[model samples]
Target: MRTLIIIPAYNEEGSIAQVIGDIREHAPEVDIVVVNDGSKDRTEAIARDAGAEVITMPFNVGIGGGMQTGYLYAYQNGYDAAVQMDADGQHRAADLPKLLAAIPYSDLVIGSRYVEQTAYRSSATRRVGILFFSKLVSFVTRQRFTDTTSGFRAANRKVIALYANYYPSDYPEVESIVYLKRRGCRLAEVPVEMRSREAGRSSITPLKSVYYMLKVTLSVLMSASRVRVRGVKTSG
Candidate 1:
């Protein structure tokens, strides 16, 4: 398959190059694209020097917009599949193949850290948020998901077109799964070990974490009842 790895970065210069290098070393057959979300640092330059295509947004559009940009690019450029990974080096490039391997059986495959429990660990606050969202989504979608907030995912052409047309504005990971499930898209999760961030810190602060929990909860509930949008046109 013509696979593209999409890394949405916001001032991730600290680890962008290393992330690109890891992808190239582990999944050289796939193409890479770095969505620089109006970063004020050298993220774009570093990603370019690392030999990945760069897509720069005018301003910080946040993860949702940046990710949608990558999916839209993949859809328009005739990529058969697309994988979403973090730019902060938490996600392992070695897991890319595992995600892609499951694409043939699923419309969207999520690389989860909690499917069978590996070395991945999180803070108490973050764990509560993750568990809450996971349970919320599993209840609404009638499918168990251990890592609903996981950004590490691979999507086939069908999901590519769907997301290109309509993606959530922010904190989209959890709600997106419910959105896809509501549309009858098949989803699967594979166990993957995630490393701690090599540089920089998480964007989520304490206050934002509270807001994230509430906002994402509402989004998931609403997404479950919303009608599926029409798929956008894609070229060969």
Candidate 2:
């Protein structure tokens, strides 16, 4: 299948090259699309130099918008599947094939941190927060989501159409799980080892994390209650 690895980059200059090169090394035939989300740094140029097809947004559109643009490009370009990965070095490229292999059986394939180990070495509060989000998403979608915030996922044609059509304005990882569930999309997970960022600080501050959870909760509720009007115009 023709797969496109869509990396949404925003001020990720330090890791973009390594990320792209790693993907090329493991999956050289897989196409890459670097959505340079208005990086104030040299992320776009570095990604381009790394041999990825770059799409520069005039401004930072956030991860949701950037990923939707990837879906648009993938659909228009006739890609069979698409994987959404982070520009940060946290996600490993080696685990990409595991997700790809499972995409055939499901519309979405998630990289779960809680699939086997629960006590991951991170901030105590952060782990609790992740578990909270996980339960909330599971309750909403009737599907267990161990890692609701993992961006390392693979999507098929159905999911591409779904996202290209009702993605959220802000954080989309959890909301997307609900979105796909509403559309009868199958979801699966595989263990993908992740690492701590070696470069810039994380954007998930305590306040931001709280705000993100609330926003996602609201989005999930809104998604669950909304009537799926057939053939209605949607922008995800």
Candidate 3:
């Protein structure tokens, strides 16, 4: 498949190069593009130097906007598949092939760490959030999801076009799945190991954790109430 890896970064200069290098080393055949979300650091230059296409936003548009930009690029440039990964080195490039390989069978493939449990550990608070969102989405969509908050995912042209037009603006990972499911998209998850960030810090702090859960919960509920698209053929 002709795949484009989209890495949305915000002030991730500390680990951008290493992330790019890991992709090149593991998934050498696919192309990569880094969406610099108005980063104040050298993320753009370092990503360019590391040999990946860089799309710099005028200002901080957050992860949703940055990802929409990358999906727009992939849709316009005619990429068969697009993969979203983090620039903080938490997502593994070695799992790229597994994601892309599942593209033929599903409209969207998520790289999940909890599908089978492979040495991936998180804080108690984060785990609770993940579990809560997972159960919520599964109940809403009537489909099982082990990791609803995972950013690592691969999308076929159908999903690329959908995401290009509309994506959740904040904390998109959990809500986006419900959006696609309502539109009759096939979604699957594959087990993958994730690493702790080697640089930079998480945007969600202890204080923000409560807000994140509340906001995402509302978003998922709202997304679930939207009318389902009729006769949407997502199968390849």
Candidate 4:
């Protein structure tokens, strides 16, 4: 199957090269597409040097916008599957096969921290918010989710088309899960270990984290009321 590993980068020069190189080594055949989202640094150059087919947006469009571009590219190129991976070093390339294996049977496969066992460590406050989001997903989708904030995920053509057509503009990680589920898209998770960022401070500072959680929760809760999920299946 044609697979695209879409890396959304924003001022991620420090870790972009490493992330791309690791993916190339582990999944050499998988097409790497780096969406350089208005980075002020050399993120695009580094990604290019690492052999990723780069897409440079004129300005920083944030995570959701960058990801949508990837989806659009996948749809246009006729790719069968696409993986959303963060440019930060937190996500591992080694766990890609499990995600790929599940994508054929499931519309979406999330690289989860608590699927089979908990192997992730983060701040306590962050954990609380994540747990809350997990419960919220379960409530909305009628399926228990282990990780709602994970960016490491793989989606088949159907899910890719959905995102390309209509994607949440801001804070999409949790909202997209609800959107996919409403469409009757099957979802699964694989246990994957996450690492600390190799560089850069997170957008979610302690003070900002509180506000982000509140804002995201309300937005998702409101959007869920209007979402419509289509049952996507392969034509035989």
Provide the lowest-lDDT 10-residue window in model 1: 227-236
Task: Please tell me which predicted candidate would have the highest TM-score against the true structure.
Answer: 3
Kindly list the per-residue Cα lDDT of model 3 for residues 187-215, writing each as its tens digit: 99999999965433678888888889899
What C-alpha lDDT do the candidate models reach, one value each?
A: 0.91, 0.85, 0.92, 0.87
Q: Give the poorly placed runs of model 4, Cα more than 4 Å off.
A: 198-200, 227-236
Preferred candidate (lDDT higher): 1 or 4: 1
Question: After superposing candidate 1, which stretches have Cα over 4 Å from the reference?
Answer: 198-200, 228-236
Local lDDT at 197 for model 1: 52
The pairs that clash in candidate 4 are: 183-229
After superposition, the stretches of candidate 2 with alpha carbons farther than 4 Å from their true spots are 118-120, 228-236
Tens digit of per-residue lDDT, candidate 1, span 1-236 = 89999999998898999999999999999999999999999999999999999999999998999999999999999999999999989999999888999999999999998999698877888888899889999999999999998999999999999899889989999988998887878999999999965433878988788889889999998998887545521221
Clashing pairs in 1: none
lDDT of 2 by residue, 1-236 (tens): 99999998899899899999999988888999999889899998899999999999999888889989999998889899999999987788898889999988998999987797633457788778788888988998788788988889999988888788868768888888987877667898887778865533777887787788788888889888876655532532
lDDT, candidate 4, 78-164, per-residue tens: 999999998887888998998999987899999998876656677788789999999988887789998999999999998899889
